[model samples]
Target chain A: MDMTTPLVEMREISIAFGGIKAVDHASVDLHAGEVVGLLGHNGAGKSTLIKILSGAYRADAGEIRIAGEPVAISSPRDAKRHGIETIYQTLALADNVDAAANIFLGRELLTAWGTLDDSAMEAETRKVMGRLNPHFRRFKEPVKALSGGQRQSVAIARAIYFNARVLIMDEPTAALGPAETKQVADLILELKKQGIGIFLISHDLHDVFDLADRVSVMKNGKVVGSAHVRDVTQDEVLGMIISGKCPPGAVAGPGALRS
Target chain B: MTESVPAPATPSQDAKSFADHLRAIEFDARMIGMIAALAVIWLGFNWLSGGAFLTPRNLWNLSVQTASVAVMACGMVLVIVTRNIDLSVGSMLGFVGMVTGLVQAQLLPGLLGFEHPATWLLSILAAVALGGLIGLFQGALIAYLAIPSFIVTLGGLLVWRGGAWWVTQGQTIAPMDSRFRPLGGGIEGAIGTSASWAIGLVICALIVAGIAFARRRRKRYGFALRPLWAEIVLAALACGTVVGAVAIANSYALPAGVARRLVEAKGGTWPEGGLTIGHGLAVPVLLALAVGVAMSFLARRLRFGRYVFSIGGNPEAAQLSGVNTRKVLMLVYGLMGMLVGIAACISTARLNAATNSAGQLDELYVIAAAVIGGTSLAGGVGTIAGAMLGALVMQSLQSGMVLIGVDTPLQNIVVGIVLVLAVWLDGLYRKRLG
Candidate 1:
């Protein structure tokens, strides 16, 4: 891989449902150690576009390259195999199971006897959760009994546990309190320092400005524009999101206002 | 990230209730509630039947009667836990039993000679395979075709029942192979006194070892440990129950005539009082218990079981986690069908006959057992041991009513009311806990 090659390159992805386009020729790229904020209104195809990358949905047309190598991700399992992890907006934790079970939901630790190594998994869970949320003590209780912040921590712990190279966090702070939100922001910075690329999808511009290195705005199922976070002001990005108007410092996509 | 770590909060020592103490010991409130209910039912029935209900003979007979339903109930827990139901188990059992009977009686006799030892094993394997195939067929329709499980199983209920009748054109097949007859409990079916005691002792040893192993594992991980005294008490209680059950089974002696026949056949003279041959543990009861243990292991320790519960808890979440939800659902149904096959063998062997009406209304009883055991119909919760106990409870009620000479119609009405009442109470208990 070239030193300047992007860690992830999603080029011209499109998907439609029932003749209605959910994502239209959207493109985004993330460099190593960079955070790209995906900003859009609800149903702006931001989630749909990211879902294709996470293997939750297949694009009607697209090319996704990892470390400059083209790869096919048709399932969540496939995405995980390529070192991609996603913390869904809903958290997606299995409510009736405990933290350990949820953290190792698909990728479980097994004993030599081919049974679930629950104690080993629990110990690993404690180690990860200690780093993420040190006050967490209810290791035996189901996730349903946990508070929102605790559950969010569990989801975050799951995503980061397996050394993901490209992490996709959809509305990571939506359900969190201010303290928890700050903790997530810190975690993003911490992950970035480790040279991990992240796609942070959010409706909050302040969150985008605070954590993201670059910003990609989507509107009406199409990418409106892209720019460095330092180059584009919040109001200019807002204009790009609301009216598909590209700022002077941003590169306009096909969906940008034709003024 | 900040370097300073906050102190972990300690639980308050004061104001702990008895329930809180139980929780501290990690006792499942639902399991205790079911046990208490079982005790009440057993005591009440014994009183109503002038103590006949508590007799060794009656209890042993009850265990045998519960075997088939208990086996199916183990599978039902997984099905219901996955937010699906198998309404066709009873009919599938009937059809599978008919096929097994036909194989052993008409087909195996020609191929392997009459009363061949291997006939029983082959018949059982055939039944299980057939049952699994039927279950998979229904599961495929539900998972792949996008049909609701309720509709698919409802159709299966009719189809399998008609198929059962068609197998023998509504005729009853009887006089199963002598070797196969022992799968059901009879004088010949039991393991006898010495074996039961040996098995009981081994189980007690296992219980103690399991507790010790768990404690060591927990300590290794620095997880909170139950008080040492609590662990000892739990192990003692479990071991005591096993020993007591074995004693009860051992106390049920063979009838005088049968005892005399056995002694005479063995070239020994029968005494004036005649020899007492204890019934010990019946084969069917042992089979049911084995199924219970295996099912519990699968549900608690296997990846497949985890996926089933996860899907039940949240289908989309499980899917997003890379779980193959459809395959898991299909396998659950297939497992249920295989269990139904085992149940069919037991019921057929016990009756020494396979009838079209065999296992009729068994679906309701199996579902009731699972529900009464605390399996939620909405999904994501249940246990195999609880379902087995639930089967015992149901069997006790039916036999208790019979011993007290209650009319059949009245018995059905009472059972129906109890099922509804149990679920209502369970709902209330869950709400209170919440």
Candidate 2:
């Protein structure tokens, strides 16, 4: 529970699919109130590594420790139980249902009669949504009708409402316009103020620079290098991603990221 | 959790402008379309039948005829909503009917020395359970084993139908226990005009209360709602339809043939003319309504229903949201199975016999009803009420065409065309909404 202990510590995770290595000996971690940016090109195995952490896939070899406590996350439920929440690119929403229903799909707030407590859920949704996106007003439409930013608000609201301490946002701003992306950035900054750690996966160098405190570059299912954002230029991080070589005189080097 | 959240939007806040009021109100557009379609179909058929179609006798018969399909269609809505189809339901019905018929007509007679009242109840329960068990088996294969629902149900269709035939060597089982007849709206199954009115009124009351509670919740959540007049109009419309249906059903008097037989059986002289209001509400129709209401509640008011729709809408998203998609799929199928059992009992009781082909081609009709009533074949969008109306529309078309003396082949051709047209219309409606 001490601030010095990283919020999440994943070690030497490896997973293979059909005799091909998707992720091999990769490690990533986040500290309290910090954003760890994971950057890699397609097929670089960054997503594969994150999926393992999100409990969508089990690593064939690895151990995950949260706040110095080893844990096994075999499913999305297990991930959530460990206070981890994922906002996938698809937003993972049921477009036919309104916001409140989508937010509480599996974990619905129920009345004494065991029926859905729609009012309570909606009130909570309104509270979280208002904080995440100040001008959001389409309360009745499904997440599909919401703009990219508004949809992100709903997803974030769901994750935050569940008291997520470790939030994984995958390409959240990828589809968003500049304004919406900025809105999401603001929301993430506010979340950081609450001491929640975020693992942000993005291809946009600008997003990484704007939000990340540390950048971890993955190439061919391995951590190319880890560096404090202030210590390495964007080109150096790009080099680490493309050639799997760490730049000289970097604050964070391979194996040196181990706490 | 933040001060950024605004004060609740009150009704008066948006009520100042009519367009604002209008824009704020969101209702199920598809449901309105269904009501309109059903009206047009009813009127068109009445016109085609030269008034015979709208008569109390024909209308009452249509309600009863729609029962089996409507009952199955309610469950089919849930099945279809969860991105699955149960093509074996028709065959399942035949299988269940065979089970019921075998027990009540053959096994019970032999075991108890004659058909007993309790035997009928026991047979009904067994038949429904068997239907559910069949559904669970198929659902498990699709959900847990990763087989497609189409394949599993398609195989079930053949296997269950063959099983039905195998059960009795294709010989018809007849003369169900006398007690079973009432449950199927046989001669003794009518609830009478007064009871029909009573039940309809009670339903109306419940519906109004439900609407009021919903409105209150919406207001509390600061969500926009339809105007008071709009709510009145919708409630009155529903209430009127129910009352009108009951009245029409009551107007059909027992024919002279039935009246004479009843008087003879009662050891009373038949008057020169005695009018007996046609049995008001067929028991099967009532049962269908009950099933429809219960299923509707489950689909709209419970966690299970929400999970089913979310899973159908987006399985990946549902899974990530921690929904147990496979379990929902299995339970949905299991529920569909139980409804099939109820439908089987109704079909058997109505036929007063169980034949191998008892529910021949009914899967097509049930699916057709669900699709036409607004359940999307693609899944994630459906309503039990709409499916029930869809059943009514299809049955009306079939019965009206038969009354018009259309050739059986031509009748099939017309239904096929109508199904295509209805689906096409649904697609267009969705596109327009988008």
Lowest summed-lDDT stretch of 10 residues in model 2 chain B? Answer: B1-10
lDDT of 2 by residue, B74-190 (tens): 999999988889999999999999988998887888988575758878888988899899999999999999999999999999999999999989999997888887777855778
Which candidate ranks first by TM-score, i.e. highest? 1
Assess candidate 2 and give its lDDT.
0.85
Candidate 1 docking band: medium
Report the lDDT of model 1 for residue B256.
88
Residue lDDT tens for model 1, A1-259 = 1269999999999999999999999999999899999998999999999999999999999899999999999999999999999999999988989999999999999999989999999999999999998888778888888888888989999999999999999999998778778999999999999999999999999999999999999999999999998888999999999999999989898789997
Q: What proportion of the true contacts does each candidate reproduce? A: 0.45, 0.53
Check candidate 2 and list the clashing pairs: B252-B278
Stretches of candidate 2 off by over 4 Å are A1-3, A249-259, B1-27, B110-113, B256-275
For candidate 2, the TM-score is: 0.93
Q: Candidate 1: where is the Cα deviation over 4 Å? A: A1-3, B1-12
Residue pairs in collision within model 1 = none
- Position A227, candidate 1: lDDT: 94
DockQ of 2: 0.43
Q: For model 2, what share of native contacts is present?
A: 0.53
CA error at residue A133 for candidate 1, angstroms: 0.4
